[model samples]
Target: MSENLKKDYQLCEEIGRGKFGTVFRCFSLVSGDDFACKSIDKRLLTDSLDRECLEKEAKIMQLVTGNPNIVQIFDVYEDDSYLHLVIELCNSSDLFDRISKRTFSESEATAVMLPLMEAIAHCHILGVAHRDIKPDNVLFNEWNLLKLADFGSADWFLGGKSMSGIFGTPYYVAPEVISGRDYNEKVDVWSSGVILYMMLAGIPPFYGESAGEIFEAVIRGNLRFPTRIFDSVSPAAKDLLRKMLCKDVSKRFSAEQVLSMSNSCLILIVLFKVEN
Candidate 1:
């Protein structure tokens, strides 16, 4: 006997907080399931716009439900003055934590990226954009798979039109976004490049003292990879980075093109070549 929604789900502990929400690890009283509840205050949103963001989060999550790389948003319920997102509790810490410890092995990167690329590529096919694609937004350990979480900043690329109101984290944003130009799927590619760079080198290519500086660096293509830092990786890895970090939206790689090479059936192919 599981109560759907009313009081608390499982009562684990407060995990983290962002500008707009708090994350909790809770176990379901019903069916004994575990879940993560992100309780976001409607008032905390940057604009009075979160009503739409919350609704969009719920709706987009429903579309993203069955994805192996997406956190399953179970329900969005509101009582007197609260909005709760009941999501499948993705157990592992974020990819950022992993990088903080050690660089990902080639196979490890492949395992992580494969399903994630599938999910994002599918999302694009479905006409959605996961505007935020930072390592902090990735969760693993639920069946040892990378589950893309936090669609709070998502935007639907609806009806073949470009929508405005800037979205995405600063470092992961595409150059076009930084320049305030009309952009699309290429934004996702840029973020994916940053993610892959982090995976291989244990940090994002763009570094800066301030947010604005980071935006400038990304837009100016001011990132440089030390041959020493990338010593173990391959030239193809650099090629991938070049394609993803292009300043021109028209010059960036598409997810389809990125996924097709596999270079050895594993796209992004990692920095190391482990035999044939």
Candidate 2:
């Protein structure tokens, strides 16, 4: 807990709420800059493990703070009853809202993904794995640039080491994770592929009425690019999705590889525009 937090910021109206706490729009008393402040109630944390998880989230946010593609953390405040996280204020809504409002064109979806992949690659370079990468955690700034947010499930991953846990949203969980197998950062790549699929097709590739059913589907890895929705999608984009959504972790593309492939896809799009 920082001593300066109380003196430095003024909390405004609540903007959002979750199981842990409420998020408020805040302003820095010194700089007059607006930010988002997440207030987590200490009482809601059932045990020491919960407290440790919250602290870990804050540390991971601090680790990846500089990138424009990720939301920046300004400070953390803790008192007897609550924990506060002062972070970048993104005025625009999350990706889920945008997708619900209307389907994104393939080009528009690619544009959204470019910066996202960059952020993921940056996190990987720093040895951080963002286990949760759903549309709800992907926000757009006022400029409409995508910024990855919500690091509550993030963890530090060392190379060649496997993390064991069935963590992550059911629809986007990697097959290895669903099978309760040891997994690494490639889990994020699987989630990214699910995001890309939903962005293009306007639905998740693996979805069920219940989490258990979704887990089964994920483990089965039954992927499809239905002609009704994906017929017009470029083969290059589908290829990338296949590589990303691969059931085998060893075959999945790394964030860096995805970025490189995305660059190639962008080039092809440009060439087609020029030729036509």
Candidate 3:
């Protein structure tokens, strides 16, 4: 977000808050659009590295603003207490919120994925990887496009920290991330794989009694597609899921490859895998 980009919105009620700052609803005077303003406190961000990571996210948002699939960062500003971020206000909540209510069909999966893939595709081309990509981080706009948000953990290949922790949601953790291996863009593929698996299966690929058990299973690369759950799913959809969740990053499907599977690819990515 560019400070030079003028801030023309008046802040409304708070919508979200995190470690760094709070998010509020606002109305944009220039575009006449509703937007969310994220206010980050520079004082709370003590670590220089972490602060730089936030800065990098803002910078990337500048490039991805025009992308249809991405959450648009309308403007950025700083005052005495905090840095204000005016981003596109997604009317709908996150995928997790939806999962808590109704069941979804395969066609619905395609609708959600179209924009998700487009935004992610943009990030990959720019060499930026969203380290955290679970259901909660994925928001929905009025059109039901999955607006990828919460870029707090997002980092580029050349900068940011040595990402070695168990970063993402336990259910979505990729093998490489669990192993503490120096990973790359492929980590996003692994997360998307988990999302796709849940979308089609109504549950994650692996299950355990505890977080330790889940991490152990992930670290071991244990994967199983039960015929009982997937009995109704198409072969092409299953094939696409297999490609996204492939343990080896070298062979996993790219966002483009997964999107190509489209109508047939629709059923397997999100409707079944997520558990509220």
Cα RMSD of all models vs. native, in order, equals 3.1, 1.9, 4.9
Per-residue lDDT over 76-181 for candidate 2, one digit per residue giving the tens place of the 0 to 100 score: 9888888899999998989989887877766788898889999999999999989989999999889987899998888788766777766788888888887878
Work out the TM-score per prediction: 0.89, 0.95, 0.84
Would you give me the overall lDDT of model 1? Answer: 0.76
What's the true lDDT of residue 26 in model 2? 90
Winner on TM-score (2 vs 3):
2
**Weakest ten-residue segment in model 1 by summed lDDT:** 267-276
True lDDT of residue 69, candidate 3: 71
On a 0 to 1 TM-score scale, where does candidate 3 land against the true structure? 0.84
Candidate 2, pairs of clashing residues = none
**Poorest 10 consecutive residues of model 2 by lDDT?**
267-276
Candidate 3, poorest ten consecutive residues by summed lDDT: 267-276
- The segments of candidate 2 whose C-alpha lies over 4 angstroms from its true place after superposition are 1-4, 270-276
Off by over 4 Å in 3: 1-7, 29-32, 158-166, 263-276
Candidate 3 local lDDT, residue 273: 46
TM-score, candidate 1, is 0.89
Q: Candidate 3, residues 95-211: lDDT per residue as tens digits?
A: 877755654566665576666777777887777778788878788788776688877777776553345545677878788888878777767777877776777667878778898
